[model samples]
Target: MSSIYIHIPFCKQACHYCDFHFSTSMGKKDAMIQALIRELELRKDEFRDEVVDCIYFGGGTPSVLETEEITLLIQTVYTHYQVTTDPEITLEANPDDLSEAKIEALHASPINRLSIGVQSFFEEDLKLMNRAHNATEALQCIMLSRKRFQNISIDLIYGIPEMSTARWIQNIEQALALDVPHISAYALTVEPKTALEKFIKKGIIPPVEDEVAQAHHAILVERLEAEGYHNYEFSNFGKPGAFSQNNTAYWEGKSYIGIGPGAHSYDGKRRAWNVSNNPRYIKAISQDMLPQDVEELTLTDQYNEYVMTRLRTQKGVSLSEVQTLFGDKMHRYLLQQAQSHIEAHFLFQEADRLYVTKKGKFLSDGIAADLFMLNLFQHPFDQNSNQS
Candidate 1:
């Protein structure tokens, strides 16, 4: 199924570890929204042959906008595309923005899912991450959101510098106790030029230990699985029937249109992305231009993309499907690349499917890269746009 992703690039505050495409100031908010609407109009034909099944309002922080602004954006999508009757519309929000009035407004609005960025449930961790919301608001918003929104997902981070295993367990237990349907947990990595990286460089923050993160991941997988949450994706856990349709469709390589500054879109053969600079993006869109770079994927490029995305999921890579879509040469190349990992017990092929073992889940990215045909093509985009 096809989808639409609108990136709202304004945030209340920048988290210490985040290097996403977002502006801390909202001075260009109005212009950006108009640009987003115009982008949707311009890219309408990309999905004309397919009806939209999901619309994701991801950000800087989508909840930073007023409810009316959110409605206007969704209305623009409906005006430009053939949306399903019950589209899975998700708004990426921060706890501080979801006041009682705001939640009530969203209940009346068309948004069906709320992906709150509640990175941690402890006050110290919140401060360490520079998250705008306090620990109380983290719990409070989820409690309040449950009253109106059932399809809710909370984003959490583990392996903070000195964060204890008990605290990590507390974070997971808190999320489970809230009965949130989906949980997207990630390890804390000190990205280059980010505050976390600088702090670590200056001995202000301790470096992230791989062992700590692995242990945390192990606890997360085991505990969440016992709690009936499926480890559907490497970083995501969801209850049965509560998986994210928008993300699942994306992971499976479906066509999607991405609007707003810094958003990326894929249309089967090629990928395109908007400019990261807010002012530049607004100026170009105002002149009726799509301020983005587009790349045409070669056969090898497509095969590598398939391997990276497919390997991260529970399904792994299907050898038969690979042969059908990518040809015998590519299929043989993949098998050749995977043999070493299978020998290491990091990967196993059962029947026609290749799956990552529990021992290899935390190292999935490196493992996927190990299987990549890097000599085929250059990496796409500036590496800064890694977050979804």
Candidate 2:
């Protein structure tokens, strides 16, 4: 099965820590949606050999779009692509946009999952992040969503400056109380050029402490695991049968078509992405011209990606699969690179699979980097190409 990610690159307000490609003024929302439909039609052959099982509406805030507009996109996908009998269609919404009426409308739409951006459920944290939603709106949205949508996920950021251990724990507790089946929690990093980065440079806010982040991460993993949520991926926790299909498909390196400004597409060997600028994308698509750049993944690029993505999952890296897919020389090189980490008790090898130990999971990025082959450096993902 394949997946589709539709990027809605518009937000009502910019979050201080966000460095995503989006415009605050949504004057071109309608034209952008139509452009997305055109792109979908034009790229209908993307996953032609597979059936689509997931369609994720990710964004600057997908909830910024009206339900009818979202439905139009879904209908476009159905019209142009071969989809599964029961597809997991998700929308990444913001608390401020998911009012009671909005929730009801979404319930009627084809969207079966709600991935809400409830970064934190505290007033101070909300204001600190410069989020559009208040603490009340955050709580209200999740509570309301719990009643209508069973497959719900919330995004929470830890490691914010001045976010006390007590407050972080409370945020976890509040999410648990809301009965969300999936939680995508991440450490707050000061992305370069973001408002938060500038704030720290100007001494307007304190920098994030790594030790504090590690501590918060421990709490998150422990609490969520105790509550029957599996830490399936480093930054993702899900209760039984609630893993994100869209994200899992991505982690497994399955083909997916991404539409909208700054969206990306991947086949087994090639990667392509649309223009990040909304006007450029809309103008190009209107004239039946493609607004995208393409890249071919070398064998080494594929191996590094495999190592990076697999190290984050519970399954870790598979030597047997590596042997078959990347051949024995690369597999041997990986094992050689990983030997030092294994000796340090950071990773464990069983039969043909290698997995990060609990102690090493917190530092998985470093461990994954350690396993990379020579000259296998990768370009950071283009910002707008992330998620929904």
lDDT of 1 by residue, 1-388 (tens): 9999999999988899999899989888898889888988988888888899999999889999999999999999999899889999999999999999999999999999999999999999999899999999999999999999999999999999999999999999999899999999999998889998888999988899999999999999999999999999999999998999998988899998889888999977999999999999999999999999999986666877898888889988999888878666667777888899999999999999999999988888898898787754343322221221
Q: All candidates' TM-scores?
A: 0.96, 0.96
The collision pairs in model 2 are 58-388
What ranges in model 2 sit over 4 Å off? 376-388
Q: What is the RMSD of candidate 1?
A: 4.7
Q: Write the per-residue lDDT of candidate 2 for residues 1-388, one digit (tens) a residue.
A: 6999999999999999998789998899889989988988998876677799999998889999999999999999999888999999999999999999999999999999999999999888889899999999999988999899999999999999999999999999999988899999999998999999999999999999999999999999999999999999999999999999988888888888888888888876888998999899999999999899999987777877889989999878999888777776677788988999999999999988999998888899999988876453442222222121
User: lDDT at 195 for candidate 2?
Assistant: 93
Q: Show the colliding residue pairs in model 1.
A: none
